[model samples]
Target: MATVELRFSAQPEHVRTARLVAAAVARRAGVDEAVLDEVRLAVGEACSRAVGLHRSHGIDAPVHVVLTEEEKLFSIEVGDEVPGSGGGASAVPGVRASGADDGDDGAEDEMGLAVISGLVDDVEVTSGESGGVIRMSWPTTPATVLP
Candidate 1:
């Protein structure tokens, strides 16, 4: 397994950068086209959510993005500090993706958590002391293989 760590501002534009980073990891893992596309979308949504809800003593802090790849599986972890500094409410986590098993692409665009869950085979949403983390994973099956 290989890991790539990134620390960047939770800015709006950084969302795209985070997605690109995740996509590169997918490519390194040899993920298939379909799975890679899903991974890219899921990770992008996860990071964007983290950045959007980020709170840091009334100041926006950088979001930490961790990308991991093991064999045909890729995982993305997005974490950030709540702007309120660190409090119970600040600990309130944001949504992960759209929803699981909801193949409706439109739903994905509508729901944040649903989109991530729909794209990834596995997803874990956890809260941190200051912010939260979203972990998303998808199988990198080769396109040449049959489902």
Candidate 2:
């Protein structure tokens, strides 16, 4: 598998860059042309969610975006440094971030994930003491970018 990793401060403005990079990489990875818009929207939702979580919780660590190109799949993972509930409550769909106390933001966060869910067919969300990641994957067209 080939991978591209990006780190950015928890800022709203940075989200657009992440979305653009994700789309370019996904295009090179052979994600269907028609689905490029979905990829961009999904990445934006994921990154925006991460940024909000970081800022609300006073976490200084950067947001993480990992794009991986595999034999037949392209997957993007967006992660946040916000701590999770020791029990992983955030793992539940539409639930609040594990340890998040931003009441209204929690609702917005859930809505963001919902949007991402609608855009990407394959998605995995996980959280723990370390952080949370939203992993979205799509099928490729057998055209992988060369080094």
Candidate 2 — what's its lDDT?
A: 0.81
- Clash totals for all candidate models: 16, 0
Instruction: Put down candidate 2 lDDT per residue, 82-120, tens digits, no spaces.
Output: 667222335434445434566655566667778887878
Q: What is the C-alpha lDDT profile of model 1 across 34-127, one tens digit per residue?
A: 6767777787877766655552234456788888877677777877565331222223354222233554532332366667767676887766
Query: How high is each candidate's TM-score?
Result: 0.70, 0.82
The worst-scoring run of ten residues by lDDT in candidate 2 lies at 85-94
The reply for model 1, stretches above 4 Å from the true place, is: 55-57, 83-110, 141-147
What are the per-model C-alpha RMSD values against the true structure? 8.1, 4.6
Off by over 4 Å in 2: 85-106, 144-147
